[model samples]
Target: MAFDYDDNNIFAKILRGEIPNNTVAENDVALAFRDIAPKAPVHVLVIPKGKYVSFDDFSANASDAEIAGFSRLCAEVCAKEGVGLDAGNAGFRAITNAGPDGVQEVPHYHLHIMGGRMMGPMVLLRD
Candidate 1:
């Protein structure tokens, strides 16, 4: 399946140096930076430097090295932000929204790492 990647998206722009970000950590395959509109005290966004529309798109096509590098970068961000289990307090939440149903604001594949406080329930029960 073809993944439609918009080169003009915000993440894409950030990757191309068209926009600036408070970079937390970065490597050859991914970049981790603070979120502009943070929902948590330590809200960081991790995205692949390569073009990807969503999690599945990345999972289906990312090279093994890309996956390893991206994962390592995320771990580095967590440690840098003091939000990982080994860092101190409680752990952080790693999230990735997919499509419209998931309220994905950006078209690029990214992970949101939130912590620094009690996050409460993962999702409200919709009954």
Candidate 2:
């Protein structure tokens, strides 16, 4: 199936200012905000202003500058939330769930910055 961007998605609305978000950081290419349902002590969502359905879509369509700026902003959010490498902890995890199997809830692409505590393994092995 072909992938298309849905402007009505919550993240898109947030990017368009149609919805309110607790913004943590922003740049010309992307915006970072605290997650409404946080999975960790420091949980932030970083999304690109451009239209992209998944991480692969964004990586394929977005410009190098946009990608770089978005990455920098994610790092900045981690640091600002005290979950960066300098934080005397186990560091943070950046995740992007792609497609249905990955359990991506929103159609728009986004990265989840989760930290501020020792995170468990990303997945459990099935025996």
Candidate 3:
């Protein structure tokens, strides 16, 4: 069964500090933690600290601060992981799964920063 992106979700509880997380980075607007089910070497899930049911929900409810923080957080993670170097910093990708059609299993919105080793071609889940 699909899970609702509501207060009861595990991520929501993590955000609320009701549960522990392997947080890699955190700012006022968002939190970055290692994905329990990692897809890559440096897989981190960046989730807004505030209430955001999904990508659309976050996009709609997020203020300028939140948006800027989210973008900055992505950059911060990339730099911290050294995913951008000439000798090669390797490569990186930021992913945000949208609605149900996008295969977003989680209800809460999050940015997936995946990189470290060479990654394969992008597979756009939606056209």
Steric clashes per prediction: 0, 0, 2
Pick the winner on TM-score between candidates 1 and 3. Answer: 1
lDDT of 3 by residue, 15-110 (tens): 888989998888999999999999999999999887786777777889989989987887887788777454367678888887766778778888
Q: What would the per-residue lDDT of candidate 1 be over residues 22-126, giving only the tens digit for each residue?
A: 999899999999999999999999999999889998999999999999999999988889888884658999999988878787889999999988888999867
- TM match of model 1 to true structure: 0.93
The parts of candidate 3 lying over 4 Å away from their true place are 1-5, 85-88, 124-127
Query: How should the candidates be ordered by lDDT, best one leading?
Result: 1, 2, 3
Q: What is the C-alpha RMSD of each candidate to the true structure, in Å?
A: 1.8, 1.5, 3.3
Cα deviation of 58, candidate 3, in Å: 2.2
lDDT of 2 by residue, 1-127 (tens): 5457887999988988899999999999999999998999999999999998899999998999999999899888978988888666569999998888788889999999998888899887777
Number of clashes in model 2?
Answer: 0
> Relative to the unseen true structure, what is the Cα RMSD of model 2?
1.5
- Each candidate structure's TM-score, on Cα atoms with residue i matched to residue i, is 0.93, 0.93, 0.85
> By the TM-score metric, which is better: model 2 or model 3?
2
How far does residue 122 in candidate 3 sit from its true spot (Å)? 1.3
Model 2 residue 56 CA deviation in Å: 0.7
